[model samples]
Target: MKKNKTLSEMTEEELVGEFTNASIAQKEASEKDKFSKYNKLFDRIVEIRNERKIRPGDRRRDLLPLLTHDNIQVRLMAAIETLAVAPDAACRTLKEIKDSNWFPFAMDASSTLSWFESGRFRPE
Candidate 1:
């Protein structure tokens, strides 16, 4: 991986790779958060959030259409990651590309929507 390059300096392909890494980290079953890979991805995701905070860039929103990326992993990652920065827009997009109910990643995206809709913690 290239070092010292800010997230803003990354190309679209590089951003996709970073998001893919994040998706992997999020989906991993191991109850570990100290791992370098996961931490690195977490930082990148935060960087994106902060970037959007300062200036709402069209480049960032460009990722919206990637929800239907030919690669399912990319499509899956795009939704959950985008949810952090663009919840309303991400939810709208997720509704269109969420694949069938049987798609595991679709379920992941659905769960993210549920997480947002139900609030952080809801007790029965």
Candidate 2:
């Protein structure tokens, strides 16, 4: 089953699909199991994003569009994924989310902004 694939085994499209579904699930339901799945998938996606950052090419372009997706979680995760390699654009995305005033997302964006200020979001 597709769900059996390890994080390293997932293609970029597959990763995006899981992230999008997780975002949808988080939005449509408040169940603990549902949110737990989203949280796990989000952590996996972030891990892969960070790993890819250490590679030699520009990959942030692929995630940039997701920053503006209709799903709040998708947008938030995309902002986190892009923060290191595309600081200016990611910061702008975070600002937009923060200004949108959706409390949860704004709070996440605000914390991410603090990471930016502290240089914790990017590798030295």
Candidate 3:
């Protein structure tokens, strides 16, 4: 039997890799309307959130560079996740995505920004 390393047991690089993979998976799951799978992926992200919290540094900032990633889903999730540590860059990335007019992702970005602006959304 193989043992799975918990998020806390993973290094920063590994954590980032997990975050990227999960973000992509969640995006695809949502696109296919696989709500259960999407929710599970989101749960993984929530685990990553705890990983970030338990670490000493501002680990969430590690995702800042991903704001410019080629994949829109990666960029979108990175922006939303890092909003607390990098508001300017995150908001800029979200705005760019929203203005790109790329259908559902653009809609997602717009809605996220709306919540952010209206004080309805707060990244932990």
Cα lDDT of model 3 by residue, 2-115, tens digit: 378888788898899999999899888988999999999989998997888889988999999899988898999899999999999999999999999997889999999999
Steric clash pairs (candidate 2): none
**Per-residue lDDT tens digits of candidate 2, residues 1-124?**
5658865676666656766676666655433556666566666666666655665576666778787798876787777777766778888888888898987778889988987888776633
Which parts of model 3 have CA positions greater than 4 angstroms off? 1-3
**Candidate 3, residue 110: lDDT:** 98
Span of 10 residues, lowest total lDDT, candidate 3 = 1-10
TM-score of each: 0.50, 0.71, 0.90
Model 1 Cα lDDT, one tens digit per residue, 1-124: 7676777787666765666666556545223544676556667676765554455454455567667666554565566556665677777656655555636556766776777678862311
Off by over 4 Å in 1: 1-4, 8-36, 56-59, 81-89, 92-107, 119-124
What's the C-alpha lDDT at position 66 in model 3? 92
Task: Note the Cα lDDT for every prediction shown.
Answer: 0.61, 0.72, 0.91
On TM-score, the stronger of 2 and 3 is 3
- Backbone collision tally, model 3: 0
RMSD of each: 6.2, 3.4, 1.8
Candidate 2 has an lDDT of: 0.72
The order by descending TM-score is 3, 2, 1
